[model samples]
Target: MRTAYRVETVRAAESALMARLPEGTLMNRAAAGLAAACAELLRPGLGRRTVARVVLLVGGGDNGGDALFAGARLARRGIGVNALLLAPDRAHPAGLAALRAAGGRGLAVADIAPGALTTLLGRASMVVDGITGIGGRGGLRPVAAELAERVTASGAPVIAVDLPSGVDADTGEVRGPVLPATLTVTFGTLKPGLLVDPARQHAGDVRLVDIGLRPLLPVEPDVAALTPAEVAALLPRPTGESDKYRRGVLGVAAGSARYPGAAVLTVGGALRGGVGAVRYAGPAHAAVIARHPETLVSPGTPAEAGRVQAWVAGPGLGDHPEAERVVNEVLAADVPLLLDADALRGLDPARVRARSAPTLLTPHAGEAAALLGVARERVESSRLTSVRELAERFGATVLLKGSTTLVADPAGPVLVNETGTPWLATAGSGDVLSGLAGGLLAAGLAARDAGAVAAHLHGLAGHAAPMPATASGVTDALPTAWQSLTG
Candidate 1:
């Protein structure tokens, strides 16, 4: 699993590590890694000495010092190096001296003409962004923002030191214009902004440079993502001694005459969720049977449905007369339950909180907004806090599904799903994910594990599907996704 720490936690760890190391050790380590990565980005032909130019956007803090030192390293290799200092008077003295001694030149941004700066940026082979560090809050200053825009216009591949500027390191929130990186070389450990969305979207690909801080960091991380191997180990596999009952049965209550396809899709995903049997109770019996003849279908409410280890309620009930009854019955069931789509409407927090079994609520940003009585925009902008608030309010595991799916329990580190494409945002996709995660719950995984694993597999299946993938396409790719992990 990959873990991410908040800015404060990382700072604490860095402080402890620096106390024991030599004065320049940490900065040297960061600079070395940054220079190596920048050199690798130069194309083969341009890599010849004196042919490639690397421009560093130098600020006033340690962040700029790191870039200056890295410029010196590249200068020693005979590559043309130039530093554009945002705060010429406050630049790191030692680092600036080192760069000059190694034949690299530093120019103050204030002194350069706009046209000249644009031309300089345009001619550069690569740009290193060191304008801000992890402690930076809000957006860049006006001059810095203008420079970043010019950098973007230049079309040079940018390598961000630590993380892209103008993004919240702790919440993954972007307040203003940001310099998007082609690659981000972070030091010591991963930051939350490098993993979560909005900020993550700007952070391109992230590479961590370990500087011996892991041992000094805290045991608990603020956020995490499951690796393929970890997901494989959590997946259910049948033993020789196992029977259909032993493998587990999932009960699904979904669909209406108006939207029978929802039932078919949900059952289709459940069948591939490592569960031995699926007992479906809904009005779409024929439609489900036509698609999956093996499903145990009943045209009745969830209460009348026979025994099940877990239940998935609400996909396309669409305010039918019995929809409320079905939700109430499922909530009363002794087995674990997954609530989604139409079933999530007018949900009672106390009823869910009182359940003896686990309850998982999967909501898109819009539904999550309704649940929390907030605007959809608020939930989207602050997903980390919103998910946690929902989890604490309902006392259940909440999965906020989007480009980056997040699973948050009432406590413990929140898990983020890193695997997925924009193509997964299709109609009826949530129904499929509801059934898949419900089946995992029936297979004996905890609410958090079920949601995280289901999201991971759901994302892989999205990738396995062809471009312009549909909801049914994602469902059909489930088996292939399973095999890629288990095979």
Candidate 2:
């Protein structure tokens, strides 16, 4: 797992590291790493004698100091480096002196004309953005904002010092215009903003500049990006003594007369997800059996769907009162359950918390907003917090799906799914995810692991599917995804 530390935690770690190291040692290390990365980007064409023209958008904090020192290194390598200081007076004194000594020129943001700035930005091969850091609030000041706007319009490759300007390092929220960087050289630790969406979109490629803060860190991590090795470790492996029943049974309560296809798709996802058996109990039994002959169709309610290790409730159930009734029964079953689609509406936050079994709630932004009694925009702006709040309120594992799918348990670390393609945004995708997660739960995985594993597999399946197709395409690609995982 790739862990992301909070901004405050990163700050504390940095402070601790600085205290142990000699003065200017941390900044020098950061600058050295930054310069090396930039040089790598310019290799073959632009050799050791750096003839490339570089532009730096310097801000006030140590972030600007990082850029200025890097600029000095570039200048020493024969690169023509220019620093556009946004806060000239507040800029790091040591960084400024280093840049001047190394033949790097500095100018105030107001000193450059609009056309001149645009022309220079367009001509430059790389632009280093140090306009803000994790300590910044809101958007950039007018002058810095204008510079960013121009730089963006120029279409030049940008290297963000710590994170993209205008992006909240802690929350991944982008309030105003931000300079989209081709690469982001972050120091000490990975911030949550670089891993989450909106802000992630701006951080093109992330590179960590190690300043020896690992020993000073407290705790492990709150959020993490699952790697292949981590996902493999979490996946359930069959044993020689295990029978079909021993592997696990997944009870699927989905589909209705109005949306029978949802049942088939959900069952497909469950079967593909390696569940031992899929017991289908819903109004669309015929449709499900027709599509998947392997699924055991039952005519009874969810409670009477026989003994199931886990239950997947409410995919395409519509607004039927019976769907709500099924959800309530599943909640009372004392078996792990994955609640999705129409089932989400049936849940009363207070009642959901009363359940004895572990519950995993999968909700899109709109559904999450309803659960939280807040606007969808609010949920989107702070997805991490919103998902955590949902988990806490309902006493369940919550998987808030979107560009960045976040899975949070009531009292555990949050897992952010970052491998999904935009094509997975199609209809019925969530149904597939619900079924897959339920299948994992039936296989005896923890609620959080089940949800996160399913999300990871679903994302890989989406990526494996043909582009410009429906979510059904992603469902069809599940076999390949599974093969890639197990193979």
Which candidate ranks first by lDDT, i.e. highest?
1
Return the lDDT, model 2, position 311: 92
TM-score of each: 0.98, 0.97
- Worst 10-residue stretch by lDDT in candidate 2? 42-51
Number of clashes recorded per candidate: 0, 0
Clashing pairs in 2: none
Compared with the true structure, what per-residue lDDT tens digits does model 1 show for residues 364-406?
A: 9999999999999888888888999999999999999986799
Identify the leading candidate in terms of TM-score: 1
Q: What is the C-alpha RMSD of each candidate to the true structure, in Å?
A: 1.4, 1.8
